[model samples]
Target: MSFGTEMENKDFKSTFSGYSKVEVDQFIAKMMVEFNSLSRENNNLKKDNESNQEKINYYMTLEKTMQNSMEIAQKTLKFSQNQAEKAKAHADKEADHIILKAKEKAKAILDHTNEKNELLKNEYDKYYNEFETFKIRVANFIEVQKNVFSTSPEDLELSPLDLTSFEEYVLKNIADSSEEVDDDELTLPELFDDEIDHNEDAQEHDDNLVKG
Candidate 1:
């Protein structure tokens, strides 16, 4: 039977043979108080367990969220590194290309300068040769004139053909060596012409003497 029914139906044979009613009643009351206290404790323990489970679930979810955030951060870092490497490579390539272009330009400038120098040297040589030739011709003309002036008047009258030949030689040398000179100090050609005029005047004087 239930504890309540047992408590209610508990009988006594008589006052002398059975237990005292007051003592039994006090013991049953004490047991009922202990059972109620134990029940309250068990209910409190169940509530605590549920609260702890909820806290555990919240912490687990937070951990999962943190893990996902870490993954994203790592991906971002890797992507940034890759982009930096690409940028550096591109910069290096552009720098190399610029350097190569600068070298090529420098080489072209040097080549053109060398070619211009060669042309200037050739022109200088040509002018030098012409100047030397002009000086030689002038000297030859001067020598011929000197020889004509040294001859006697009688010799000139007798060898008129030799005088003509000397005159022709001077004219031919001057004509062959004539060139435009860009100097004011050189007066050989003009002096040679004056000498030729003087020789012609002397020849006319000798002719007048012969006729007289």
Candidate 2:
């Protein structure tokens, strides 16, 4: 704002009691020209500083925005990770539940199978015992019949009875010739006549067959 070193080097002529006016006016005019130049430069520098401060403020605001974005991104990523972990845990739990249910179902199926097998075995045993008992009884009956109807081989040949007609023909013939006597029932006149009629009819059927 003040003059340059020229003002300090240049001296004014002394008048009666003060400096010369002409010289002072000339130096003052030159200092005003330089001061005006410095003033303009100072104003430009101030404008440049203000512009730089505005740019710095804008960059600081952008940094804040970027910092906020990063924080939000991190938070979102953390939230997603937590949700994924929960999903995995839930899936594992479901898997365990399914496995447990399957195991229980398998056990139930096995138990049912074992029970059915046991019941089948019991039924088989019961039927086998019944069949064995039936076989024993049939064997005893056959033995009894064998003992009661036993005859010598010669007698069997002598009396070669036809088994097809044995009940109706051979028994009557054998009884007629037997030594054992049970004459009470045979003495009944009505039954004896029925028997005689039956024998007559059988003899007539045999005669017709022979004629044919």
Candidate 3:
């Protein structure tokens, strides 16, 4: 019989030389004590095993959670990198536009300065040419007037003192009559057949103008 069935049945075979009844009963009692101790130990071992299994399951769950957190962190880092790249690109584009605008502004300013300088140079050349023409016209007029007076016929007769006073009056009137003359509006004398020299008169007039 199985050990468990034998223990429960407690039936013993009797013979003419069987063991003592009290001794057998005592042995059975001792065996039952040992079996009961083993049963309690087995139950404690089962409880320990169950506790170990529960710990293993909790550790598995924690590991899975840690893995998920790592994945999330990686994804966040990638997203941030993408955003940084985009922001940098935008900043670069804006900087290029600003640089281009500054270049255009500088070019415009340079072109305007060049144009203004050209206009000033042209005006200076024009004024110099007009002054030269005015000087030539004045010299020609003085030469013609000198020649006409030197060759003129003398018809009027008067006292020497009266003639002197009349000449002075005429010179004063001619000197004062043409103040603020415009060269552009002046009517030049007709050209003579030959060139006339008025270098001395021109030099004297220029000196007088400078002194005034």
Candidate 4:
């Protein structure tokens, strides 16, 4: 009886030990599954971080490019403004030069006109003086002819005088006188001889008429 009891106790202890080993193996398998799940999640988080960093770098590059473009635009605008100002200054100078030239031309024209007017006035004055001198000379010639004819004696008859014959004789005498008398060399006695000879002939002709 004692041997059988000891054998039964040993058999019970062996069965319990076998169940503990199986439980420990199952626990180890569950822990391994949990560890693998955690490792996969960590790898996925690292990939997401890399992708976010690449996006931030791209945005930073775009910002730098835009800043350079803005700087270039500002420089171009300043250059255009400078060119405009230079062109305006040059145009103003050209306009002033043209105005000065026009003024000079106008002054020259006015001076020329004034000179011409003065020349014309002087010419008119000279012509008027010459005309007045001619008129005075004509009047003096008529007066001298009248005085010489009036002082002549009426009885010194050369012919029965018609108007035509008298005019012919007077014209002939005028022509002969012009040839013989030089005004600068003529003496006063020569001028009186013609009147004295005519009066003596008139007195002699009257004495003969009274006797007839």
| Global lDDT scores for all candidate models | 0.69, 0.65, 0.64, 0.59
**Which is the winner by lDDT between candidate 1 and candidate 4?**
1
Cα-based TM-score, every candidate: 0.58, 0.58, 0.58, 0.48
Q: Which stretches of candidate 3 lie over 4 Å from their true place?
A: 1-28, 139-212
Task: Indicate the worst ten consecutive residues by lDDT in candidate 4.
Answer: 3-12
Model 2 residue pairs with clashes: none
Estimate, for each residue in 1-212, the C-alpha lDDT of model 4 and write its tens digit. 44333433333244643767555556655655665566578778888888888988988898898888889889989999999999999999999999999999999999987886686577557545644543453344355457446644353244545545444444444445444333343233443454367446655754764574
* Local accuracy of candidate 2 as per-residue lDDT tens digits, 42-148: 98999999999999999999999999999999999999999999999999999999999999999999999899779668856765665565455445434533643
Off by over 4 Å in 1: 1-35, 151-167, 171-212
Rate residue 87 of model 3 by lDDT: 100
RMSD of each: 15.1, 17.1, 11.3, 22.5
Clashes of 3: 0
Q: Distance from true position, residue 187, model 3, in Å?
A: 3.3
Clash number for model 1?
0
Better of 2 and 4 by lDDT: 2
- What's the lDDT for candidate 1? 0.69
Instruction: List, residue by residue over 80-195, the lDDT tens digit for candidate 3.
Output: 99999999999999999999999999999999989977866785576566556556655545654564355433322434356454444333333344442342321222122111
- Clash count for candidate 2 is 0
Maximum-lDDT candidate: 1
Q: Pairing residues by index, what is the TM-score of model 4?
A: 0.48
